[model samples]
Target: MVNIRRIGLVATLCASVLSLPAYAQQYRFNYSKLYTQMKNNLEEGHPDVKVAFFFQEHKTSRLCKIDKAWMEKDKHYEEFVIPPSQELIVPLDDNLRQVGPLVYVNAEQGKTCDFSMVVMTKQPLSGEVSYQDIEQLLPQMSKMLDDLGGMFSSWFAPKVIGLTFEFDGVKQSAIQTSKGNTFSIDNGKAKVNLADLSKNESLLLPQTTFRVLPLLEK
Candidate 1:
């Protein structure tokens, strides 16, 4: 006779193990790989390869204040106060200016809040960037963006907010998100369909501008 209790336990264990990958996928944005890729592009003289780091701070957090007690001992605490919408330009060739992980505190709750950095790069990136490039990076990038959002908001998910590629001086930007996997573009008077380009290359063009934003749903 089949042991019903043992079978149930086995099924439970299998479900738990199967869910591990989905959980990891939910929180695995890799900043190190991103930094390396940016550095490489800069070294190869990819034209106008600019990197931007975005940070978010809560309005009432003590860390947001210039004279917070924690700031006395922390040297890099000031960087956290930069406005979320503002961009911190990172010099890809300069190690000192490269992006790194950062930590912050919420004084009211006496709890430490962590932030995952978001990066934006603009340049001529046709062959350099693509859906495949993003697909590979999305797992990590989504986790990072969601981490940042978690610092202040109770609701957050992974999303790509903006992506634009300039081809022959005609700027094409992603205008809409379809099923959270595909994006439509604003071709901007260009004869060629930007969507077709994305489909063909499975990559984002180099010298492209893109923003990884938080999604409301996974």
Candidate 2:
């Protein structure tokens, strides 16, 4: 008989009749198992940082629900499922460039949802450029973060907020704070009132860098 298979395969009887389209295996995601595994893994890795996550797309994304009805009287079965290895992306930079190691999570659990985490290793802190010129300046910025954090506690604060203090060189930036009174960097200075800054003592201004720091309240 003339064997019409590929040369190499023909020697092996066409590789046992091509073996059922190379056995394309479709994975059925065990969502319960997968969600538990991912959550446990993240907790084990980062102990100190409390991670809270919310879904960008609720029902449409990972929380897809499918319902079916049977021929019996008032009988039906329903299930929610998502594809294996779905994408979870986060905006890493001011440019809004996204990066990911995505997965499906059990979002039905409310705040306790088993979210797919894309733990970013590190990112360059912006606005602190050349801050080494005045490394001590961080406490100033940190105070700003705390202040903004407090500010937010009082009202609905935006995730990204900014306060500036205008000096000769505008520290032009957004600052997150718990305090509602976010400082501003206007006219080359952190837009703080000199009267609120200090009615007690002189602010020994650091001359090394042009950016100013919010004065410590008396």
Candidate 3:
């Protein structure tokens, strides 16, 4: 079952650039504050769960829809054909910045929440493994998942509030979970549906600018 959750809209329409200069630059958004918030939420809700990330599909224009679906759903779960980017199960800490795709896991309101979303160009991906430790086959795991973009959110019978992520002192995203999945986000849009969006993650309406700053020197 594809469990979906809703958290309203966390990302607003900020300034958008028509196109990048010939020398495409990688922009970074300082998310130390947000990461700290996520860590706290993970503790209260996710416990020992590992949060991660994955890139969007290429040319089909599905990212905006995925992002939008992610905002409204409880579990924020969905499965799709992988484009070219990879998925990374990030380690818990306060020193990590944006990578390929970013995801998180937690137990909110007695439900399991999983979110896999990112804003990177579509590219081939590698390496992905089940959260369970396969000590016997440690050498047979890949760090990326190819051809499938899956975000699964499952809630249990016990009623509870899911983990949430706040930014700039605002509750941008929260996981209001039910027995199953409830909300979704794709194609970079937050309030639309899968059917209403394109199958690819290519630029559609416009690019959502996330100004990322490198704090390594700081």
Report lDDT (CA) for all predictions.
0.30, 0.26, 0.23
Which segments of model 2 are wrong by more than 4 Å? 1-29, 39-45, 50-53, 57-173, 176-218
How would you encode candidate 2's per-residue C-alpha lDDT over 1-218 as one tens digit per residue?
Answer: 11111100000111111111233211123223233323422433233211112222333323211111111112332232332222222222222112212222233222221222221111212342222322333233333223323434224322211222323333454332223334444333443333333223223222222223233322
TM-score, predicted candidate 2 vs. hidden true structure: 0.17
Model 3's C-alpha root-mean-square deviation from the true structure amounts to 20.0
- Per-residue CA lDDT of model 3 for 2-90, tens digit only, reads 12223211121111122234422221222342353235323322222222343222333222112111111244333333322223223
Residue 110 in candidate 2 has what lDDT?
28
lDDT of 3 at 182: 33
In model 3, the Cα lDDT at residue 163 comes to 17
Global CA lDDT of candidate 1, please? 0.30
Candidate 1 all-Cα RMSD:
16.5
Worst 10 residues of 1 by lDDT: 6-15
Q: Please write out the lDDT profile of model 1 over residues 50-157, one tens digit for every residue.
A: 334332233321121111111112354333343333433333434433444322222213222212233323422344444454444434333333333334422433
**Residue-level error in angstroms, candidate 3, position 91:** 5.2
